[model samples]
Target: MVLERFDAIVFDWDGTLLDSTAAIAGAIRGAAADLGLPDPGPERAAQV
Candidate 1:
């Protein structure tokens, strides 16, 4: 059997390397508010 080697491997997490954190959190909060639910706040929204 033969084995191969890779020079590099990459891994990413959702929203880890992007600038959409605030936008996403805002959307969540907005949707909740529109439905007359309480705002999740930025920290909770981000965690969701």
Candidate 2:
């Protein structure tokens, strides 16, 4: 099979390009808890 190349490629940021804000925040919180650190909430994580 041959692949076709397109001249223009449109991408979506918020939904398509892995906008996992909540997942990242949860993972950070879990990791912090595991390492005995404060639970940085979603807002804080996003800021960082």
Candidate 3:
């Protein structure tokens, strides 16, 4: 086997790359709810 190298690499901060925002937000809300805290809601959870 051989290894190859790339000259440039790019990263995307938006959800387009990983698209795990909703999962992350849901986890946050679930954790908060488990702790008896009010749900931050979708919009607020995204911000967090």
Candidate 4:
């Protein structure tokens, strides 16, 4: 019903509607460490 009423729907949650930089950075760092890789640290991780 909702889809039929609207031709399209958009969601803006990619750091614009909501900021998840810290969480995303942490996940990246954790993944790297899980593989025995060096930690990029907060700075580098944020850049990524």
Best by lDDT: 4
Query: Considering TM-score, where higher is better, how would the candidates rank from best to worst?
Result: 4, 3, 1, 2
Q: How much is 2 displaced in model 1, in angstroms?
A: 33
lDDT of each: 0.87, 0.80, 0.89, 0.90
Give per-residue CA lDDT, model 1, range 1-48, as digits (tens): 899999998867555776678888999999999999999899999876
Question: Which residue pairs of candidate 4 clash?
Answer: none
Give the Å shift of residue 34 in candidate 3: 0.3
Model 2, 1-48: lDDT tens digits are 999999998878665888777877788888999999987877897664
How well does candidate 3 score on lDDT at residue 25? 93
Compute each candidate's TM-score over C-alphas.
0.60, 0.54, 0.63, 0.76
Off by over 4 Å in 4: 1-4
Q: lDDT, candidate 1, residue 5? A: 97
Better-scoring candidate (lDDT), 1 or 4: 4
- Quantify how close model 2 is to the true structure by its C-alpha RMSD in Å: 4.7
lDDT of 3 by residue, 1-48 (tens): 999999999898567677888898999999999999999999999887
Which candidate, 1 or 3, would have the higher TM-score against the true structure? 3
Residue pairs with backbone atoms closer than 3 Å in model 1 (clashes): none
Q: In model 1, what is the error at residue 43, expressed in angstroms? A: 0.5
